[model samples]
Target: MIIRKAIKEDVPSIVSMIADDKLGALRENYQNPLPLRYYEAFKRINEDPNQELVVITNAKEDVIGTLQLSFIQYLTYQGGIRAQIEAVRVHKTYRSKGIGQKLFEWAINRAMERKAHGVQLTTDKKRPEALNFYEKLGFKASHEGMKLHL
Candidate 1:
């Protein structure tokens, strides 16, 4: 498996993979032509010094997994940086083969390289496996992060 930074060429596959996940209902809103908003976000994240998108591919160059990482500057912790992991998913066929773990480890190490004070991620409470995975990766629960869905 090869892990590399994402490029525009990877967008179609990435979008398709996310759309295939039942948990991706939230993303379906941006499907079809995959609006400018999505493009802008991909560009912003890929171009920003503190953000990144990684694609895991087979030796054949077919993408099998992907993740988005954001390195944010936080003033609450004396301006220390925090890396946020988002949209992490592995193809169903690739699950249970240590691909997700490897991708996560790579993200965490990259965050450290950027001088981030910590790395964090959020998963649905219903996803017990995701919760367990994060715990195994040494992440402790911080607090309840409430969201206002309007």
Candidate 2:
């Protein structure tokens, strides 16, 4: 398997993976000829130097997993930069096959390479298995994460 920066054409596959689960089904608007908004968001992310949207592909180059890493500069931690990982998903068929672990390993290493002081990610409380998987990768529930939806 190979992990690489996602291109525009990979949007649909990525969205499919994102929408495969119960929670994602409620929030993601994935459909045939997928909504224009996904592509628009991809363009914005792709253009940002601090954002990375990556896809993990199999030997045939089929997209099987994806994640987005955003580097944030902050005044805390001695003006350090932290990498925030989001939207991680592996195709249903690819789960339990070590793909997700590989994805995280790559992202964490990339964050270090980019000089990030730490890497962080938030998994929905509803996803206990996901939380467990993250814990295995050495992440801690260091702080309570809250969100305000507009």
Candidate 3:
């Protein structure tokens, strides 16, 4: 599999991967005349120097996995930059094939190259398998995550 930064044309495929699962089916919309918000967000992420929306394509150049990495600079860690991994999705057919591990490895290497203090990610508590996968990748459950939806 070849991993690379995602382009606008990959949006539909990415959306389909996201909506393939139960959780995503509840929150993602994959319909004709796809929402403008997705495209707009993609454009913004593409334009941001600190954010990367990446896709992993198969031998046929079909997208099979994707994830986002964000570099955040903050004062708390002595003005260190932290790499945040999010929106990870591997097509159901491609799961259990080590694609997710490859994706995380790439992200971690990218963070190291950028001099990030550390790498972090959050998995839904309901996803025990995901949590275990992350732990196997050397991530720790160091803190609680909270959010307020608008």
Candidate 4:
């Protein structure tokens, strides 16, 4: 398997993997021809210097997993940059093969390479297994994250 920056063609596979989960099923709209908004968002992400959208592909170059990493500039922590990881998903058939770990490792390394002060991510409370997996990766429950949907 190879990890690389996602291309336009990989969007469908990425969305499919994302929507395969119970939580994601409610929020993601995956169809034969995906909605225009997804592509528009992809375009914005691709054009942004601080955004890195990546995909893991199999030997045949089929996208099987995906994640988005963002470098956020903050005045706190002495103006340090923080890496925020989001949208991490592996194709249902590809789970338990360490693909997710590999994706996190790559993202964390990239964040370090960019001189980020820390890496952060939020997982839904409903996913106990995901929380455990993240804890195993050395991430602590250091902060309580709250969100508001606009």
Model 1 agreement with the true structure over 32-119: per-residue lDDT tens digits: 6776677777888888877789999988898999999988888977889999998888878888889999999999999889888988
Q: Estimate, for each residue in 1-150, the C-alpha lDDT of model 2 and write its tens digit.
A: 999999999999999999999999999999999999999999999999999999999999999999999999999999999999999999998899999999999999999999999999998999999999999999999999999989
* Residue pairs in clash, model 1: none
What's the count of clashing pairs in each model shown?
Answer: 0, 0, 0, 0
- Highest-TM-score candidate: 2
Greater TM-score among 2 and 4 belongs to 2
What's the residue-level lDDT of 108 in candidate 3?
A: 99
Please give the CA lDDT of all the candidate structures: 0.85, 0.96, 0.95, 0.94
lDDT of 3 by residue, 17-117 (tens): 98888889999999877799999999999999999999999999999999999999999888999999999999999999999999999999999999999
> How does model 2 score by TM-score?
0.98
Return the TM-score for candidate 1, rounded to 2 decimals. 0.89
Q: After superposition, how far is residue 72 of candidate 1 from its true place, in Å?
A: 0.9
Query: Which 10 consecutive residues of model 4 have the lowest summed lDDT?
Result: 14-23
Q: Give Cα distance to truth, residue 138, candidate 1, Å.
A: 1.6
Q: How should the candidates be ordered by TM-score, best one leading?
A: 2, 4, 3, 1
Which parts of model 3 are misplaced by more than 4 Å?
A: none
What TM-score, to 2 decimals, does candidate 4 have?
A: 0.98
